[model samples]
Target chain A: MNLTDQQRTLIEQIGVWHENNGIQPAAARVMGLMIVSDKRELTFDEITEALSISKSATSNALNLLLRTEHLEYITFPGDRKRYFKMKISNWREAFTRKIDDLTGFNVLLRQVLEVRNRNCDESDEGLQDFISFLDYLHQELPNLLAKWEEQNKKS
Target chain B: MNLTDQQRTLIEQIGVWHENNGIQPAAARVMGLMIVSDKRELTFDEITEALSISKSATSNALNLLLRTEHLEYITFPGDRKRYFKMKISNWREAFTRKIDDLTGFNVLLRQVLEVRNRNCDESDEGLQDFISFLDYLHQELPNLLAKWEEQNKKS
Candidate 1:
């Protein structure tokens, strides 16, 4: 489907945000388009035209997105084209990983603490404090997720 | 102070991790060195030699890390040389921003929902559901942080 001016503008805005977050430009725009496009699913050609991107670029971006679980595909009974759709539901895993990564440093922080000289007591204590703080966050995330889900069900 | 083989290896590991997260290589290594070093602080020449990085590259990385608040500098009464130190304390704020950025999408999500064609029901509802999920997370973060702090005090 052809995009409206508003849709095109929104795509760029979303695209820029994703690109700044380290996603390559083509892949970022493709994801932005999938979210903003009116159609629930798009053929490979539709994605290419919507973003005005090259075929190889679109193919590469699609592969990256699919591999990353941001997008998924389906084939119809008689259709030769693959329909790509958003797998945003999987974002809970992605978002959870982002939060977990905060606490994930505990492992390395411990490693860091292990090798420090005993004379660097202050900073060593600082590292230990940070580790406990991260451990607290890690333990508490499940509680937060449960709370978010519980509230989500209510509303 | 010269970095030990163990320290150098740790620096490389930490530097690689930071670089994967989009930090420039020189800046990443410099930050890693500051964290793993035995000294609480390092001077300009020291950072350069320790990293075996060029003067210009070291200078740029120092400026980047200092500006980003990951490192800070000090001046001594008699010493002309500046001593740069770790500011890992500021990371809590950085981590807070990371959490906030997940929910930060609500503003843009609402905008995306606003302009979508009414017929695009499934994806629109999907976006709406995602927004509310994010809203729940946003509302609940402070409570999680408070809980973490509370638990930290008990232990």
Candidate 2:
């Protein structure tokens, strides 16, 4: 399949950034190929040929995507080759992880604010302003997750 | 200030991961320091001394944090040295970036599913099942974000 230059650039950007952030670039490519392909699940051969990467690279990339739970592997009764398709059932986990990461940061941030406020007498209005926001965010996280889970159950 | 061994190990983990992911280890160190320090903001010398890194390393780390908008610079009128503090005014932005990142992946995943679903003939139940989740995830994202944002606003 032919991709426009803009599409190709976007794929490259996603690949490189994800790689730089400790994820594999080829996984990003496999993701890119599958997303734009006329067919959703692609075999290793198709992916390798499409991305012009080595078969080993394609193999490794696909494996990593599977390992990360972002994609799934499918085997047919009569087919020798395995097929990969995006895993959407676990999307809630992805969102949860995002919230969890922010929550993690907030835990650290709140402690800092607490100590700073306690020691400095809370005279700095800027500090108090930022502190109030952190406190509010920290307090709100659990309710937000509960609400999201409620919505998830409905749909 | 001395960090406990456990705290040091956690800091090291964060530092190494960020470094491998293209962020400088010292940048991660600065982030760690700010998170745990009694004072939220730190001067260049304080960061250097606290992290046991060089002044230049502290400067570079602080600059990286500034670029990411994770931390900001502060100036007191009488003091020539710059102070840096974590930007906690909008914790939602940090979480939102994660949502945006997922959106990027979701968009690509949806495209792949569309293409592959088309190629899977009526008899190919396995391939169709393999990609079904992508469509579901694409549909859920808008509602998820709206709920999260609504909670964020209420908080």
Candidate 3:
């Protein structure tokens, strides 16, 4: 699959952004390519040829993406080869997971507060305020996700 | 500034978490210390001594934290040394800034959609759905933050 210069630039920019966010260069490049591909899906050989990456590199990148739920593969009738595409819902799930993890950490923070209360004088109003903020977020994030789901369903 | 065994374990655990998130170990240690400190404020020497980090490492970590607004310092009347404390509000600001950046990215995605619409057959329902999801988030995230603020005010 030949890429226009503009498409190439966009792919490279996406790759750079993912790399900045700590993804490996090859996997990031694959993700970038997958996002901007006109077909919205590509075979393994096509991905390797388009990105000019080695077979092993392509396989590794694809496997990582699949393991992380960032990409999914499909097979058509009578087609032995698999075709891969971006999993857009996975992006939403990733954000949701981050919020969930923070909420889980709030439980730990509450336990820490109990310990602090037992061990120290109850004078650190700032610490108390911070805990209160975390508690507020813990209660609100689920509702926020629910609201997004409700809006998404309407749209 | 001596730490109990439990405190030491907690600090180390926090440092490991930060390291996994791509933060430097020294800076992560400083963050952990600041969070659990009974004093709520510490001088340069105090941070170094408590964390067992070298003076140069302490300075570098403190400077990074200060630059990122994760920590702030103040000087007392007639005192030459600065006392530093964790900036809990910065954590809130960081979350706010993340939502803002995502909202900003929605504009870029809209442009991408326009270009894609012109260049492609517009058969990619998945792409359109992803864009719609982003648009929903762009509209809804501010309300989530506002709701958090209202709840915080009440509590």
Candidate 4:
């Protein structure tokens, strides 16, 4: 499908930002394309040809999305080509899992500090300061999440 | 700073996941390092030297973190070197802003859809469906944010 000049520029902007942020732009591109396309599900060839990226790049990118539970694969009863679609199925599940992952990582950090702190003398100001930082995160994250929810409700 | 074999492996695992997800591993590494390190703030050269990456990479990555408001830089009165530290100042701000950016982009997509949908009529079910998908995102994000907050509190 031919993209207008404006659409082309917008796509490039999104791609660059995604790349910089450490996300594969292809998935976002695919999402954009699927959302804008006349057809909801396009073949592998169509995706590669449209994005001008390699098939492997598209495949790897899509695979990551699927693994992260962001996208799902589809097959029409008679159609041979598999189709892909975004899963907004549970936005709560999608976003919360990521946040939970971050929190879990924080908990691991606290454990490390606990073990290490015990081995060190109380005079180790450096270690104490670092542990304090983790403690701050532990306390702050819950409130932050609450604020996001409140803002969400207001909006 | 020499890392144990186990530490190195763990770092690499986290790095790969961040890279795959489109986030720079350096930021993740830095966060990981902070969690494990005895020291709180690491100098620019120290992070670069520890990660075995170029100084520019460290600088750019740290600057990006600073811009995102996830990190802060401080200069001690006696020390000439600038030190970087993680800031848990506004976890909600960091995430809410990103969601806001996504919402803003949808506003543009909606404009494009208005034009595209009107022109396609019955022939373009895919395009219409795509627009609906975005419309769903627009509607559901705030609700998701609320749920995210509740989950955070329970944790």
TM-score of chain A of 4: 0.64
Task: Kindly list the per-residue Cα lDDT of model 2 for residues A37-143, writing each as its tens digit.
Answer: 55667788888887899989988988888888878979999899888887745555764565565456445444444443335555344444444554555455556
lDDT for each candidate structure:
0.82, 0.63, 0.75, 0.61
How well does candidate 3 reproduce the true complex, by DockQ?
0.34
State interface RMSD in Å for all models.
Answer: 1.8, 6.8, 3.7, 7.2
Query: Which lDDT value does model 3 have at B71?
Result: 92
Off by over 4 Å in 2: A1-10, A13-22, A103-118, A121-155, B1-23, B96-155
Query: Cα deviation of A103 in candidate 2 (Å)?
Result: 4.4
- Please provide, for model 1 over B1-155, each residue's C-alpha lDDT reduced to its tens digit, 9 standing for 90 to 100: 76678888888888887876778999999878888888888999999999988999999999998888888999999989999998867767777787677655667788888877757476576678788878877777777777766877787
Pairs that collide in candidate 1 are none
Instruction: Give the backbone clash total of model 4.
Output: 5
Best by DockQ: 1
lDDT tens per residue, model 2, B1-155? 65556555555655654565467778987766665565667788888887888878877878879989979878999999888887855444764565566556555544433434354455243333333443444455455555545665665
How many clashing residue pairs appear in each of the predictions shown?
Answer: 0, 8, 0, 5
Off by over 4 Å in 1: B118-120
User: Model 3, range B1-155, lDDT digits (tens) per residue?
Assistant: 87777677677776766665557899998987877666777999999999998999999999998988889998999999999988866766877766666665555455455444334555555566666766666666667667766876776
Most accurate candidate by TM-score: 1
Instruction: For model 4 chain B, give the 10-residue run with minimal summed lDDT.
Output: B115-124
For model 1, residues A45-141, the per-residue Cα lDDT tens digits are 9999888889999999999999988899989998999999989787777777866666555666777787756474766866777788778777777
Tens-digit lDDT track of model 4 for A64-108: 878877677789798788787656454446445655656555555
